[model samples]
Target: MDDQDILMVSEAQIAESFDADGLMLKPLTLFIKTEHPDVIERELSVLGFFSISTSTTPEKTPMYEFTLSPLNT
Candidate 1:
């Protein structure tokens, strides 16, 4: 994937997408749950999250990144 194709989305958005489409229609780049750690543990495990911390702002409010697993069945 190229830099232009990258999209960062939260877990809620991921769920919404999955629910609306019944599956992931497009490839997801980084899956994030924001400052919510509990959601990360339960929601992102199936995607095989890499669980990396990122600083989205200058104050660096800790953001979480989940590396998605292959969706192909």
Candidate 2:
């Protein structure tokens, strides 16, 4: 499969999703977003060595992000 497809499949496998009010993203989530931003940017951008996005709700504001690179990447 293409890289984008691979990324989508991988995210699906992990069942990762963020709530509008969530404060933190799990390590695995950050790692995946970091490693796959180029392939995944068609939908979202993973910034600051991890995927970062503003909350759709004004109350949520900025969201802190984190991630660890895969051993194989």
Candidate with maximal lDDT: 1
Model 1 alpha-carbon miss at residue 2, Å: 33
User: Residue by residue across 6-57, what tens digits does model 1's lDDT show?
Assistant: 2367777567435464665444446343555555556556455233333243
lDDT scores in order: 0.47, 0.34
- Candidate 1, 69: how far from true, in Å? 1.5
What is the C-alpha lDDT profile of model 2 across 1-73, one tens digit per residue? 2332221125552445333553333435332323344444434443434443321223342222323323322
User: Which structure among the candidates has the greatest TM-score?
Assistant: 1
Give candidate 2 regions above 4 Å deviation: 1-5, 9-20, 29-46, 49-73
Error of 1 at 47 (Å): 7.4
Name the lDDT value of residue 38 in candidate 1.
50
